[model samples]
Target: MQDQPLNAADFDAIESTLLKYGDDHSVLNPSELDGYFTALVSSPEQVDIAEWFPGIWGGQNPAWETPDEAKQFIELSVRHINTLARQLAEDSAAFAPRFEQTEHLGHDVTLAEEWCFGYLRGVAVANWTPLPAIQATLLQAISDCAEQDNFELPQDLDVVAHQQRVAAIAPAVRALHDYWLSQR
Candidate 1:
């Protein structure tokens, strides 16, 4: 099951389940989880499931309502991880980070903070070494978005600037993935 890509129903189930549990736990939401998995898949060194699985619930396993529920969650998560790896390997252009969408100043914008944070979390879990200067610059782009305060935006930030910064993330991600692939 981990080798198979999740269908729409499976994806929806994973998202809904995370939301259901997120109320009382620190579990990653769908978009954040997607980013987290992306980082793991793109890392030059592979991370073991045991090391990163606990990150889904912020370092603790949830007391699932049933064994089957836990099984399903694990299965879906593994499948998603595999799917990310396959996408990045076969068609990097098809890769898209999951982001929350909302209107800011009457302009549609993507909220990448959580997703970026999740990616950073995965980076930490992977214990990556110092990247080359160019790769480091690409990573800095992601770090900037992740470091934004949850409630406060920079005073000078305009909608267009924000969109431009968000737009850079995908290309940066693709480049970073390529860099890591070359390293491997």
Candidate 2:
């Protein structure tokens, strides 16, 4: 809500850069980064960039492959996501979490899971507080969602149900935010 507004153009280049270099090294996509940022800073506790960056960039293949521009992307993304957290906390109707995926998938598994994983990693690095029951449950749900089990989808599994589960990220983020705030 300051001089810079959270928008796509600021991060659009990162995706293109990832396409050029590849996103395999990166644990999170642009969209997940945004969600993760909100999850971290939305809390009352201040999350240091030093603490969170390693979790975000760790395990990335071609470890040093990230260009300067990519680093800038994270900086800009933090700013944008901070703004997003403010909006969400204020119950702004215009707040919509951004996703890096261009096309929709029949089963968008990674969308919420990666974002949650990023959030989990951030929380791990901060280690400032313990999670309440709801937060713990959501984290478990996301972990389940992220699993890449080599098995067929249940024939009767409802697509709507799965989508609903994935769609819970925003609310879950809000809950975590409130939890941390209350602790503070």
Worst 10 residues of 1 by lDDT: 20-29
State the TM-score for model 2. 0.69
Which prediction has the highest TM-score against the true structure? 1
Give per-residue lDDT, candidate 1, residue 32.
81
Local distance difference test, each candidate: 0.84, 0.59
Worst 10 residues of 2 by lDDT: 100-109
Q: What TM value does model 1 have?
A: 0.89
Give lDDT tens digits, candidate 1, residues 6-36.
7879978988878877644354577788888
